[model samples]
Target: MSDGWILGLDLGTSGLRGVITDETGEIHAEAAAPLTDQSPTTWSAALSGVLLELKPHLSRVHHIIADATSSTVMLWDNGVSSPVLMYDDGRATQEYAAIRDQLPADSAAHGATSTLSKVLWLRNHCPVSSGTRIAHQVDWLNAQFLGFPPPTDWNNALKLGYDPIREQWPDVIEQLLSPLSPPKVVPSGTPLGSVQEAVQDTWGFPHQCTVHAGTTDSIAGFLAAGAQALGDAVSSLGTTLALKIVSERPIFSPSHGIYSHRLGRRWLAGGASNVGGGSLLEMFSLEQVRALSKRQPGPKRGIACYPLRGVGERFPEADAKKAGLWPDKHLPEAVRFQAIVEALVAIEKKGYERLHALGAPAPQRIFCVGGGCRNAMWQRLRSAQLPHVVAQTVERPPAWGVTRLLADEGP
Candidate 1:
C-alpha cells in the first residue's frame, strides 16, 4: 500500500473543505473555501481555489476521495447543466409521486426531492439530449480530478434508486427511465482511476495518485467520527438533527424517514429530524443560546415543543402538514429555551427507539457532531433522556472521513 498522504475533499452545501493526511491519520494540511452559489461554474471555481490552496502538499498525496451533500445533482453533456438542482430543491412533486407509486413503500426515493425524482423531472422538464448524463455533486466535483462521467459510490446513489444490496441498478428503475443512463455504481472506497494529467500538471499532484469512489457527506461525517462498531452511532446537531447508527443489518422505513447506507459488511442506519439547533436559533440568538446554556435545566416542564422550521416533519414522525409546536407564549425566555432543548432530545430518543424497533442494533454509544454538540447543557439533556447510550462529542469533518476511504480503512 502507498504510504503517501491522502487528500479528502468535501463539497458541502455552503463551501468546500479539503484535508491532506497520511495513512496514520496525521493531518499535514487543511483548507476551506466558501461557495457563493450552487452553479456548476461556481463549484468549479471554488474547487479550483481550494485545490490551489492545497497545491503545496499535492506532491505527497497518493489518492483522493470526496463526499458531497446528499442528492445534489446536475445534468452533464460536454459540461454540467445550468442551475443544478440542490439536494433540498422540491420542484419535482409530480415526479416524486410517480416514483412513490412504483417503488416499495419503504424505499428512500419516496421523498419529493430525492435524486431519482430529480432525474425524472429532468427527463421531462429539462429534456436533455440522449448523450447527456446524470451526476451528483460528489461525482461532478470528483470528475474534475479523475474524469467526466464519474462513477458514484453506493451512498450517493441511494436516493437515485440504485439497490445497494443487489449491487446493481434495479430493472424497474432502468425501465422507468429508459431515456437516461445512470453512472456506474461502486463500493465507497473502490478505486476508479488515476488523477487526470491536467490536474496533476496544474496542481503538482503525483502522477500515480488514484481517485477513489466517494459517498454522501453525511456518511462521510459518520465515518470521520470513527463509529466502526456495529452498534456505534453519530448524532449531528446542525441546522437540523440527523442520526446514523452502524448496524450489521440494513433498516428501511420510509414512512418514518429511516434508511440505510451500505458500509462494507455492515450498514449505516438512521434518520434526520426537523427539530434541532435551527429551532433554537429562530427564538434566540447565538449569544442567547449560549447564555441559556449556563442555566441549569429544571425538571421536565412538559413543554412538548415539536420544533419544526416549517409545515412538515420527517423523522420520528413523517407528517408533511405538521405544524411547529412550542411552549405557551407566556413562558419565560430561559424556561422556553430549556424546553426546546429537551424537546429536541425527546425527538432523538424516539428516533433511536424507532431504529431499534426496525431491527438495527441498539446504539451502544452516540457521538455528537455539528454546532449544537457544543452546548454542554444540551448534551446533558440528551444523556438524561438516552441514559442507556453514552453521549460524547467528536470532531469529525467529512473531509477526514473520505481520507479514511483513500487509506482503505474501515469506518
Candidate 2:
C-alpha cells in the first residue's frame, strides 16, 4: 500500500466538492462549496475555498483526481491557464453553426453541450481570445492545482471528438481545428504532475502529492459502482436519465440518440432521455410527487405518456411534440401517474435493449444511483420490467470514483 491518500474533487454543475480518500476508497473528509455562478472567477474562488477546508488533512494526501460535468467548458488562456469563458456561460450560441457545418455528415457533431463546440463558438465571438487553450471542467480544475495546463482524460475527451479507440486525436479533427494544437490527452488514471509547491504550501498539502487525470462525473459514478463485468451497467436518475453499459466496443446510435463513452479499457454505451422523475416535480411539488406516488394505484392502466420536461430531446426526436397520456377506459389519476412512471422506465429499458440489438451485449445487473434510487416504487417497477436482471443501489456520489482513479485504489 502506498503510504499516501488521494483527493477527489468533483466540479459539480451546482458546486465544487472535495473528498480526501484513502487507498481503500473510504472518504476521510469531504467538503463542498456551491458555485456562486458558473463563471471562471467564481469556480476558481470556490475551489480555493474548498482547498482551505481540506488543508488540515493535506499531509497524508499524495494524489488528487477530479470528476466534473462533461458539459462544462471554458476558454483557457495559454499564458497563465486562466479561464476566459465559463462552461455554463452560453454566450457562444451563435458559434455552434460554424462547427456544425464543418462536421462530416456521417460523423457526430457535439451539440452546444460539448467543450469543443463551445470553444468554437467562443473563438469566433471573442476573436481576440481565439488562441486560448480550451479545456473541459475536470481538466480546467486540475490545471489550477499545478498552476499549469492540465491534460484531459480519455472518457472526458470522447465527446469532444477525441477518438478513444485509436488512442489518439483524429487527423481530420486536427486539420479542422488548425492553429490550436490538440489539447494534451491522457488516460484517466495517469499521473500527470504534482501539486505545485505554491499551492502545497498555501494549502498545507504534502509536497509529494501527484495529481492524476480523472473523468466525467458519470464515468466516475460507473467506476465507483464496480461496473467491471462485460454486462454490468449503471443508471443515474436525476433531472435526466443518464444510463451506461460496459461494452467491449462503441455502439453508435445517432438514430436512437445513443452515444458511447470510453471508460478505461471498456466502452460505456448509453443515452440520456428527457423523461425522469423531474417531470413529476415539474407537474407537482416534490412533496406532492411523493404523496402521489404513495397513493399506489396498483399496475398502470396502459396510459402511455412520454413525459418531457424539456423543449426538445436528443433521443427519439419524435417525442419533441410532448405527447400526452394515452387515454384508456377512465384510468384513475394515480393509475395514470403510475403508467407514466412505467413508460419512462420502459424508455430506459428500450434504450438498453436497443444497444444490445446494435451488437453490445445485455447487462446482467443494473446498479442504480441518484434520486431515483430512493424510490421503492420505481425500483420495484424497474425490477419487474427486467425480472431476470438485478437492480442494486450503491449510494455513492460521483466523487468517490474520481478518488479511485487518483489513488489507484481498487474496489
Residue-pair clash count for candidate 1: 0
TM-score of candidate 2 to 2 decimals: 0.90
Evaluated against the true structure, the overall lDDT of model 2 is 0.72
Clashing pairs in 2: none
Best by lDDT: 1
Residue 394 accuracy (lDDT) in model 2: 59
> How do the residues 7-41 of candidate 2 rate in per-residue lDDT, one tens digit apiece?
88888778988888888877898888898667667
Cα lDDT tens digits for candidate 1, 1-411: 456889999999889999999887788899998999888788888888888899999999998889999999877787747358898999999887776788866667778889988888878877578788888898887788876667889999898888877788877888777688877898988888998998899999988898888888998898788777879988898999999999988888888989999987899998998888999988889999988887778878687788787999889778899999887769899889988898888889889989999898887888888988778789888877784544544586889987776554565
What lDDT is reached at residue 295 by model 2?
Answer: 60
